[model samples]
Target: MKRNSYAIIGSGALGGLYGGMLAKAGFDVHFLLNSDYQHVSEQGLKVQSTWGDFHLPQVNAYDNAAAMPACDVTIVALKTVRNHLLPDLLPATTREGGVVLVLQNGLGVEVESAAIVGEDRVLGGCCFLCSNKVGPGHIHHMDFGRIVFGEYSRQEITPRAQTICDELNSANIDAQVSADLGAVRWRKLMWNIPFNGLSVALNASTKEIVDTPSSFALADAIIREVHQGAAACGVDVPESAIAKTMGNTVKMVPYDSSMRIDYLNGRPMELQAILGNPLAAAKASGHEMPRVEMLYQSLQFMDKAAGK
Candidate 1:
């Protein structure tokens, strides 16, 4: 079987871990990094994972996409806030007929990439990973590392999507294909909407939020509201999804969500992509998610205030 070359556009925590795994498996993987470019280029990438510790002495690291080789699979692991750069990066890093896999969180993420690469060549991935960049060239993988791939604007699992999943599994990253992109996205939001926002709103970790009855209840309420919002948008998310998210979160490592870490470091949270877009979708269907709307408003205020 032929292996697919990969380009990791954002070599942050999630990107670094997955890209590093691919590189460790001897696949052709190129990383386009920003702040960690110098460190990773000089010292290689380091991963401290629960599975085990590994180090790549050298990697294909570049500071810009133009300098990187075009690959069969171009993975966009960028924070949705920096998605504006996709117009420049996607065209530069993706080869003709290559697919663009979007690994960012929240709804409607694949739309921008699809517009650039064409719908048939766009894939959205819902990542269920708990990892963070602790330092330059270093990623801490605390727990959970599974990704569900879904074809954009389609409900069938394409062969290309399955092939990518096979490659990811070969690299020891648990991956599978989903027929319904919208459903998978909403299922991810079941956890993201509550935990990401509440982590920042209450200055709490996953374990803390789960341990506190009040915060946990609020999180549960928000999850149900998200379910309704998904239904309003014509997506059927199972009730078991709510229980599954909460159950898994309870067993999760006590860790800071990506949004919380961004807040602590004075960086912008993914307020628009994660919350604002979902709210808009719900409202478009003439259904309102009051709890979600409230959370979104609070996050908006917090994000703006933190900018000052």
Candidate 2:
């Protein structure tokens, strides 16, 4: 199959890893860098992964969307914190019928994304991976890099969706299509809700959050709350999903979550996309996730405190 043209909108860690892998596989991957535009243009993306380390010494990079050609598939790998920029970015590069896959954490993203790119063009991606950009043009990947592919406005997999997944697989991404996008988002959130919030609020790592008794129980409670919230929103995430996330956390590397890293660096964490949006949806459905709510407030306080 002919590979689709890929334009990575955000040049952060997630964007770098995914886009770098695709580009490394000989796909026509264009990286749209916010800060690392010049550096990546000159030095290319450097990916160091446990699977193997590779480098792209020359790359198709642009600083602004206005300079990019319309791509067959546009991966909006921006942190949900920067989603407000999507409308501006898409207009210049999202060709009609091109699929826009959002590779970000949290809920309510699909809805907003569909509004921007049209339902037909909006696809969703959930990345089960641990990776980060350690410096300009350099990414450090730890483990787990499978991608769950789904459509935002429909349950059935379109041929376009399958092709995109196939393309990702061609690029060495463990990509697969699912009939349910909402369940995938909520299932991923079972881990994100606890680790992301507590990783910051408690100043702990993933290992500390699950290894310690008090924090572990709180993690369980938060997971259940997220499960309940998912149900109230009409998605039945199975018990196994919760158990699986807990199990993975127990054995995975002792890593700092993106939120914790952001907090420590004094950059704004994605408090809204990961926690606040879900909480709002649950509250609207009359489901009160008390423990998750507390974590939300604490993160919010820290976010506010970090401000001048």
Candidate 3:
């Protein structure tokens, strides 16, 4: 398998977790840090994982994307709230024919990323990852660190995709390629729509939300709504998606959702991409998502209340 230098645009929890794994495996991974640049530069990244704990004493960290050399594969882990910076981040770090992988939560993300990096060079990745950054250069991995990748156009796995899978798997991160991008996107949403929203609205952790019967029911309802939205968009997501996601949540480590953490930090949550984008796609296909609509509207209000 071939490995290329990797650049991470958002060096937060998701970025640090995956990129750190790659770097530990000897892949040249350049990190574009945010506010944590100084801390990470000083102490490097310390990862405490359920699987194992490791520390990288030093990393190639840069605050400016322009300073980072063009990479053959660039993984974007930016929150959709900061998606407006995608164009600014991609052009400088991705070379011609380089793969731009988006490890994000939401619908139609590939469309926007593809617009900037060309569809043929774009691959969509959905991470079933449970990890967080405790402090600058500090990460905690709770459970579940598998990643699923799909070609933007839903084609068979190409050599590039296989190479990517090989690289991640070499780093001990389970990686799979999906031939159905639409189904994969909606399947990821089955969990995101419910947990991300309820976590923020109810001010609780994953365990708290799933342990409560009422909240669990609410999550189920959102899952059903998401399933319907997927079907309306001509992607028939099986009921197994909901069942599998629920089963995972039941066994997941007690944790704060990314949205909940973002809200607590007074940052803008990704309500638009996770809620509004799918809702628009569903409505365009003549289907309405009442449960998800309520969640979306409530998140909008909560976002405003947070002054983000």
Candidate 4:
């Protein structure tokens, strides 16, 4: 078996967890860090996972992409708001013929990546992860670490996609290859839309929102609207997905969403990618998600008011 070397573009919570797991499995993994560069370079990476706690004493850490070696696979885990850096980071860290896997949330995320790396060399990954970067060089994995990914523009699970899935599974990470990228992305949005948006809007955690009747009802309505929007865009998301998402949330440990964390930390939120793009797509398909649009506007207002 050919082991693929990996370049982790955003060495934050998601990137650190996945890349740390790969590195722990003995694959060559290069991490590109920003603010944590100094800390990680000196102390290495730390992972506090539900499965166990481990640390990599020595790691291939680089502060700049140009200083890192091009690798077989480049996993992008940066927030959507920082996607502007992909154009430079993708080409710099990806070797020729290598693929780029986007592990961020939202609809049409692969579009920009594909435009830079070509559609065939790009894959979209929908991550069901509950983890956070507690401090420099430290990641805390709470629960759920499954990734469903597929080619950006293809309907078949290509060999490249399967290979990545196999590698992830080998590292004890639950990974699966999907046949339809669009459908998978929309299905993931069934949870992201309500939980991520309402978490900040209502100033609550996943359990708080689910435990409250009014908030839970709002979340349910938003999920239905996302299902309608997906249908309008020619994607068939099963109606049963609504119950599944709600049930899953009800069981998940009380955790703060990425969006809520960003807002509370006074950082920019991913309004354009998460809300703006999906709303535009639905509107173009002659569907209107009123609840989603209202949430979008409210979030925008809050973001501006906080100067984030």
What are the per-residue Cα lDDT tens digits for candidate 1 across 1-308? 87999999999989999999999999999999999889999999999998789999899999988988889999999999899999999998999999999999999988889999999999998899999999999999999989998898789988899899998999999898999989989999999999999999999998999999999999999999999999999999988888888999999989899999999999999988899999999999999999888998998999889873
lDDT of each: 0.93, 0.87, 0.89, 0.93
Q: Quote the positional error of residue 100 for candidate 1 in Å.
A: 0.2
Regions more than 4 Å wrong, model 4 = none
Q: Which ten residues in a row have the lowest lDDT in candidate 2?
A: 108-117
Q: For candidate 3, report its TM-score.
A: 0.97
Candidate 2: give its CA RMSD in angstroms. Answer: 1.2
Give stretches of model 2 more than 4 Å off: none
User: Looking at candidate 1, what is the lDDT of residue 83?
Assistant: 93
**lDDT per residue as tens, model 3, 1-308:** 45788999898888999999999999999999989999888889889887689999899999999999999999999887787898888998998789899999998887778889889889998988888889988889888888998788656888888888888998988899888878878888989999999999899998998899999988988899999899999997888888888888999888799999999989899998899999999999999999999999999999998786
Each model's TM-score, in the order given? 0.98, 0.97, 0.97, 0.99
Against the true structure, candidate 1 reaches a TM-score of: 0.98
Clash number for each model? 0, 0, 0, 0
**What tens-digit string does per-residue lDDT give for candidate 2 at 105-151?**
98877666788878778888788888877898899999888889799
Clashes of 3: 0
Residue pairs clashing, model 4 = none
Q: RMSD of each candidate? A: 0.9, 1.2, 1.2, 0.8
Q: Which should have the higher TM-score, number 3 or number 4?
A: 4
